[model samples]
Target chain A: MTSKQQDKDIHQYDIHQKKGFSSEEINAMSQSVLNEKLDNIDAVTLSRLHQARQQAVDAAVLRPSFLQRYWPDRCNLSRSDHPILQPLVLVGLIIFALGTGYLMSHTRTDQLNLGQGEYLANEDDLEVAEDLDFIAWLIEQDKVSDNHAG
Target chain B: MQAQQQRNHLDHFLARVERRAFHLAQLATGQTQPALDIVQDAMLTLSKKYAHKSPSEWGPLFHRILQNKIKDWYRHQSLSQRIIDWFGKKSSVRDEPDDVIQTAVDRQTPLPFERLKNEDLRQALNMAIEKLPRRQQQAFLLRHWEGFSVKQTARVMQCSEGSVKTHVSRATQFLKQQLEGFYHDQ
Candidate 1:
C-alpha cells in the first residue's frame, strides 16, 4: 500500500476503534487474556519476581530518609558512618580553632599594649612628683641659708 | 514516626504496582532478566527519590521512572551493540531472528475467549504492541491498559496531551489493523 493509503486506512481504523464497533470488546478481551497470561506466569519466573520484590522491599527499608539519604552525616552528627562529613567536620574544627587562636592573640596583644601604656604613664607621673619634691626641699634649704647669712 | 509511615506507604505502593510494572517492562524489553532489573531499578529509584511524594503522585512517578529506565537500557544495549559491530564480532543482537519475538508471548497460557482460540491472533496482538515505537507503546499501555487519562499519560510520557492523543490514536489504529480479523469474526 502507498504511504498515503496506509495513513488513510490507519485513520479509519482509529475512528472505528474509537466508535467502539467491536474494537472495545476486543480490547477488553485482549486485556483479560494478557492479565491471565501474567497470572499464569511460570513458577520459576514467579519465584524470581518474588525474590526481586523482596529484595526491593528490603532495599527500600534500608534506604535512608531524605535527610539521611542526602544530608546523611550533615543531618545526623551522631552517625559516624558518614564518610563525607568526618573529614569535613575535622577541617571545620581546624579552621575554627585557628580563627579563635588568631582572635585571642590579637585581643591579648591589644590588652597588653593598653596595660604598657598605663604603666608608662604612672611611672612618668611618679618621676615628676619626686623631682618636684626635691626641688621644693632645695628651695627651702636655700631660704634657710639666706636667713642665717642675713 | 512520619518516616516510618512514609516507608510503609512506599512499600505498599511498590507492592501494588510491582507485577504490572514487571509486565510492562517485560513487554517493552521483550526479555525477562532486563525487565526484572528495570522494575527493580525503577522501584529503587522511586523509593529513593520520590518516596516522600504524595501517594497519588506515585503512580505516574513510578511509571515515568520505569519508562526512563527502559529507555536507558535500550540506549545502553544499542551502544554496546554498535561497539561490538565495529570490532567485527558476530553481534548476538543481530543473530536473533525477528520471529523469535513470538517466543516471549507464546510461552503464556491460553486465554478463555472463543474468538481468541486462535493463538496466532493473540501472539500477533502481543507482537504488534511490542513492535510499536516506544512512544506509541507507552501511550497505548498507559492509556488503555493502565487506564491513565490522556493528561496523566502525557505527564508520565513527558509529552503534551495532544501528542499523547496522537500516539494513542496511532497505537489504537495499528492494534486494530493487527487484530481486525478477531474483531470482525465477532
Candidate 2:
C-alpha cells in the first residue's frame, strides 16, 4: 500500500487480526519486530518488564512482603495460621477499653481525694482550737454563751 | 466460613488474571519493579475497596485501580523524566534517534529477527507492544490481545470508544509497520 493509502486505510486494519499468520509465522514475525524494538529499548526497560510480571504475581499471591505494610500481621507469622481479629475490630476494642479504664480510674481518684480532704480538715480543727489567741478565744466564748441560751 | 469462601473466590479470580495483569502493568511501566509495586497497590486497593462489589465487577474494577496507579506514577514523573526514569539516569547524556525519524525507520525496516520461534515471536510482540505510546498500547492490548470489545477497552482505558478506535488504529499501523519486514521476508 502507498503511504497515503496506508495512513488512510490503517483504520481498516483489525486490532485482533488472527487470520493469516500461523503460529510459526506469528512467532517469526514477532521475533523480528521485538528485536527491532529491543534495539531501541534499553536494559533498564527490560528489567522493568521483568519486575512488572513478578510483582503482579506476588501481589496476587498476597505474599507477606507485599501485605505487611497495610496488614497488621507480624512480619514472621503466616497469615493463614495466625488468625486474629481484623485490624479494624482490634483498634475499636483498644479504644473502648482505654476510655472505660480512664473513666473508672478518674472517678475513684476523685472520691479518694475528697475523703482525704475531709480527714485533714477535721485534724486541723483541734490544732486551730489549741493555738487560738485572744481574738479566737473571745469568739469561742461568745459561741459557747449563744449555745447555752439556745 | 462465608468470609473464607469469599476470600477463596477472590484468590481464584486473582490467580486467573495475575499474569495478564502483570504483563499489562509491565507494558505500561516498561519495567518490572514499578509495575510490580503498582500492581500490588492496585490489588490491595481493589480488595479493600471493591472486594464487596459483585464478582462481575472485578475485572473493570481491578483495571480501574491499576489505571489510577499508573496515572499517579506518571503524574510524579514528567515526560522527560519518565523517559529518563524508564531508560535510566546515567543514560541521559546519550543522544536518542529522534522519535519521528525512528518512527520512519520503524515503518520501513524489517524487524531484525525474522526466523525466531513462535514463543520468541510472542515475546517480541509483547516487547513491541510495550514500546508503544501508553494509550495506544493499552488500547491495542485491551482490544486485540485481551479480546475486550472496543466499548470495554474504552471503559478500561477511561476514554470514549472513538478515542479507543483512534488508539487502536494508530497502534495497529505502528505494529504492522514494525512487523512489515518480517512479513515481507516470510
Candidate 3:
C-alpha cells in the first residue's frame, strides 16, 4: 500500500480519531510523519547531532574543571549568549578576589599589631620576672657562701 | 568500572532520544540551527547534571531543559537576528537541503516523485504546526509528539495538570481544524 493508504489504515485503527476531539494525536499519522522526518534528517545535521551527543557524552565522562563545576554561568557564555559578558564577569571576579585579599591582609596586619600591643602591656611583668631571677641568683650566692664558711 | 557503565547508559539514552529531540526543537523554533543548538544545549545539560539521577528521571529533565532553552531563545531574539534568520532560511533551505528525499538512505526509501503526495501532508502539517501559538504548540507536541502523559507533560511544562489538559484539548481542536483538508483529501 502507498504511504497515504498506510496512514489511512493507521487512522482506521485509531478509534480516538473518530471522536473528532481526541485528546491524543490524530492517531499515529502525524507521529509517523514526524518519525519519517527524523529518518530524513540530513547527514550533515545528523552528524552534527551525533557530534553533539558525543561532546555531551564526553562532557559527562570527562569531568568538568573546577571553574565549570562551581561556576556554571561562567562556562555558558550564553547569559543571553552575549559571550562578551563572560570576560567582563571574569574580570569582575578577579577584581573582587584581589580586593578581598587586600582587605584580608590589612586585617591580618592589624591583628599582628594588636598582638604586639598585648606584649608591650606585659613589660612590667617582664621586669618582675627579671627581678625574681636576680633574687634567685642572690639566694644561690648566699647559700654558696654559707657552705664555704662552714 | 561503575562510572564506565553509567557513561554507557547515558550514551545509550542520548542516542535514543537525540533524533526525536532534534525534531521537537526544530518544530518549536521553526529554524534548524537554533534547534540544533538548543538540542545540544539540552543534551549537555542532561549529561552534565542529571546523568547521575535515575535513568528514568532523564526524560522529564531533558524535556524541561529543552523547553527552558526554547523559552530563552524566544526571550533573547533581537529583530536584526530575526531578519538575518529569515534571509538565512531561504539560502540554507536551498543550499543545504535537509529535505526528506535528499536525506533518505535506505533502499526502500521513496523517491521524491513517489514521496510527493506524502510530502504535501508533511509540509501542510508542518506549516499548521508552525502556525500554532507557542503554548498550544508546545502542549500538543509534548502531549502527543513526545508521547508524554498529561501528568508528565505538566511536570515538564511546569504547569498544572488542568492547564496541560486544557492546552492539549485546545491544541487538538486547532490541529484537527487545520489538518481537516489533509485528512479529507486522504
Candidate 4:
C-alpha cells in the first residue's frame, strides 16, 4: 500500500470517529465486516474456486492403487513434468485397456455372427459365382484363340 | 465404498476451508491470481500428502501448507523485486491484472463517505486490516478471524506461543489505532 493511500485512510478516520470504539469493538467490527466481505466474494471467483477444489481433490486424493504404491513416482508416460501426470497416465491406460477389451469382445461376437451367416447363401453371391464360371469359360476360349494366333 | 467415502470426506473438508483459505491468501499476497494460486497449491499439497490421514489432522496440516505457500510467495516476490531494482526503476511494478483486496476500498466498491451508512465502518475496517504488517495480519486473521487458539496459531506460524501473542497484541493495537485514531504509535 502507498503512503498516499495510508494517509488517505488516516485522513478518512479524521472524518469520523466512533469515539472510544474499544479493542473489543474493533475485533467485533472486523469480524462482522470481514464475514460480510467474504460472503460477498464475486460469483466468478467462487466458481473458479469450486473448479480448483474439484481439480485438487481429483488430482490428489489418495486411492493407493497398486501402481501408485509400488511405483513411488506413479510412472508417467507424458514427457511433461506436470504433477497431474501420474493419475492422468494411470486413468488413460485404464481407459485404453477398457477400450481394447471392448473391441476384442465385440470382435469375437461379430465373428460368431459371421459364422452364423456363412451357411445362408446370399443370392448376390450366387449370381457372382455364376458370372465367375462364365468368365472362366470366356477366358479359356480367349486363351485357345491366342494360342492359335501365336 | 471406502474410496467414495474418502472422496466425500476430502471434498467436504476442502469446501469448508476454501473461502477462508482464499481470504488468508488474498490478505497475505495482495494479488487476486497469486492468492488463488497459493490456495490451490496448498489444497493440492494437503490433498496429495495428507488426505489419507485422519480428518482431525487435516486442519493444522492445511494451515501449515497455506502459511508455507504464502511465505513462498513472499520470497518469490522479494527476489523478483530485487532483480527489478537491479535492472531499473519502473514505477508500474504492481500492474497486475486481477485486482485483489487492494481494489476493494476505492475502485470496486466506490461509495462516498457522505452516502455511507453502515458501509463506512466496513470500509474502514478493510483499510485498517490491509494497512497491517504481514505477520501481524497473518497472526491476527488466523487467531481472531479463523478462531485458531494462540497455540494453534503458533503451530501454524511455526513460532513460539509468546511470539504469537505479541503479534496478535500488536495487530490488535495497530488495527485499533488505525480505525479509532487512538494509541497512535505501534
Candidate 5:
C-alpha cells in the first residue's frame, strides 16, 4: 500500500483501538509495565544512577551561591564595579565631613564669644572699681600733706 | 540557606525522575551505557542551569532537556557513522568481515519479540515499544507512560500538537497490533 493509505489505515486502527479499550485502561497497562521495568533495573545501573544524582547535586552546589545572586560583583570593590554604592559612599563621607567642620567652627565661635563676654563682665565689677578709686584718692591726699609739711 | 533549599529541591526532583528518564533514554537509544550517560547529562544540566526555576517548572524543563540530550546523542551517532564511512572508503574497504558476520547472525537469530509467545505480557509490551520508530516510541512513552498532556508532549517533542497526535496515534495502532493477544487475554 502507499504510505498515505497506510497512514490512513493506521489512523483508523488507532481509533478502533481507542474505542475498543479505554484510554485510562491502556495508560494503566503501559504504566504498570514500565513501572515493572523500572523496578527490575539491575543493581549496577542503580548504583550508576545514584552516582549520577550525587554528581548532579555537586554540580548544583558548585553553582553561584546565594550571595552571588544578590551581590553579583561582591568580590570586586572598585568604584567602577559598584556604580551606585560608590557614589553613595563618597557623597556620605563628604556630607559627614562638612557637618563635622561646621559643628566644630560653630562651637569654637561660641566659646570665644563666651570668653570675651566673661572678661568684660569681670572688668565691670562696680564695687571693686569704686574701692580702688577711693584708695587712689586717699594716697594722693596724703602725699600732698607730706609735701606741704616739707 | 536559599542555595541549600534550591539544591534540596533539585535533588528531590532528580530523584523522582531519574529512573523514568533512564528508561526513556534506554528506549530511545536501546543501550544501557548511552542511556546512563544521557540521564546523567540531563540531570547535571537541569541542576546547573535550572535549579532556580520553580519546582513546578522543573518537571517539564528536565524532560525537555532529556529529550534534547537524546537528540544530541542521535546527531553525534550519525556524525560518527559518517566519519567511519569516510575512513572506510578512504581505506578502500568494500565490506568488513564483522559486518558480514553480524548480518549472518542477525538473519539466523529470531527477533526478541518473536519469541514472546510464552513470555510475559510486560516483556512483550516493552519489546514492542523498543522496536517502534523513534518519534512514535517517544510519543507513546511520553503520552501514555509519563502521562504528559498532548500540548506538553508537543512542547517536549518540539513539534506541532497535530503532529504529536499523529505520532501517538500511529504508535498506539502499532502497539495495539503487536500486543493484540496480550491485551485481549487481559
Candidate 6:
C-alpha cells in the first residue's frame, strides 16, 4: 500500500483501538448525571432567573434598544415637507396674506372709505391733493403770463 | 414557558457536563474557585442565550464561554499587575498555603491502595488528559470523556472533521505516551 494509504489505515486502527464509552453506557451515564444535576440546582432560583430573562426579552421586543431604534433624521425627511422647513413656510404665508390684504384695501375707494372710518380723507391725503392742485395752478398761471408777454 | 422547557433542558445538559467542565477548567486556571466561577458563568450564559440549542451544540458553546471568561480573567490580571509593577510596588499576593500543605499530605497518604488501585490509574489518566494542549484537551474530553462522535467533536471544536481527527489522535498519542507506564504496569 502507498504511504498515504498506510497512514489512513493507521489512523483508522488508532481510532478503532482507542478506548471509548459504549453507546449504552454513555446514554445511561449522561441521563443519571443530568438527573443528579437537576435534583441539586435550586428550583426557585431557576424560576426567578427564567422570569427575569423573559421580561427582558419582552421589553426588548416592545421597545427596541437605542441602537436598534436609530434611523437617520436626514433620511427620514423628503424635500417638500421636512419638520424644519414647515414652521418658516407657515410664518411666511401669514406675512404674505397680511401684506396682500393691506394693499387690496388701500387700492379700492369703497374699502378706503372703511379705512377712512366715516371721514372722507386723512390730513396726509388732503395735503397730498392740495400740493398737486398748487403745482397745476402755478403751471396754468405761468402759461397765461407767458402768452401775454409774447 | 417554551423558554422555560429549553432552560430546563439546558440545566440538565450543563449538569451532565459540569464535573468534567470543572475538571477541565481547573486544569486551565490551576485553581478550583476560579474554575468553578468560570463554569458557573458559562452555565448561566449557555442557559440564557443558547438554551434552545441542541445537545451537540452545548459542549462547544460552554467551552467557548469558559474560554472567554478565562481569557478575560487573565487580561484583567495582566493589566492590574502591569499597573502595579509600573508603580514599583512588589505584589503581596501569595499562593494558597493550605492547598500546598494539603497536597503535600495527600502525597504521603495512601488510598486503600491495594484493592481499588484503578482509582489511582484513572486519576493518572485524568492528569495526563488534562496535560494535553487546550484544543487537544478539548477534543479528548469531548470525544472520549463526553462520548461525542467525531462529527460532534468537530462541531463543538468549530473545525473540520479532519482537524478533529488530528487533534484527537495527537491527544490520544500524548495520553498514551504520558500514561504508558500506568497502562503497561496494569
Write candidate 2's Cα lDDT for B55-90 as tens digits: 677887788688889888777555667777777774
| Candidate 2 interface RMS | 9.5
lDDT of 4 by residue, A1-150 (tens): 999999989866864454545566677767776676666567667877898899888976665556545552434332234657667767888999999999999999898889636644788777777898899999999999999999
Name the runs in model 5 displaced over 4 angstroms. Answer: A1-24, A61-150, B89-118
Error of 5 at A59 (Å): 1.3
Give the share of true interchain contacts found in each model: 0.15, 0.09, 0.39, 0.45, 0.38, 0.00
lDDT of 5 by residue, A1-150 (tens): 899999989977985675444455555666777775666566667788999999998888435566445442444564345668756756887999999999999999998879645644775665676788899999999999999999
True contacts kept of 1: 0.15
For B63-108, candidate 6 gives per-residue lDDT tens digits of: 7676677667667767877898899976732243324422232333
Q: Give me the TM-scores for chain A across all models, comma-separated.
A: 0.29, 0.27, 0.33, 0.29, 0.30, 0.24
Question: Per-prediction DockQ, in order?
Answer: 0.12, 0.07, 0.20, 0.18, 0.15, 0.03
lDDT of 5 by residue, B32-140 (tens): 7788999999998887876765688778789889999999998988777789887784322212232232113224323433232435776777787888999989988
lDDT of 1 at B44: 80
Residue-level error in angstroms, candidate 2, position A110: 34
Question: What's model 6's TM-score?
Answer: 0.46
| Best model per DockQ | 3
- Of 1 and 3, the candidate ahead on lDDT is 3
Give the distance in Å from residue B106's predicted Cα in candidate 6 to where it truly belongs: 14
Better of 2 and 3 by lDDT: 3
TM-score between candidate 5 chain A and the true chain A: 0.30
Task: Put down candidate 4 lDDT per residue, B24-44, tens digits, no spaces.
Answer: 888777777888899889988
**Cand. 4 TM to true fold:** 0.62
Q: How would the docking of model 1 be graded?
A: incorrect
Candidate 3 residue-wise lDDT, B1-186, digit = tens: 877888888889999999988888877777778889999999998888767666887898899999999888876765545677878853232144355643455655443432335667778777777777888888888877888998889888888899998987777777777766665556
With a 3 Å backbone cut-off (N, CA, C), the pairs that clash in candidate 1 are: none
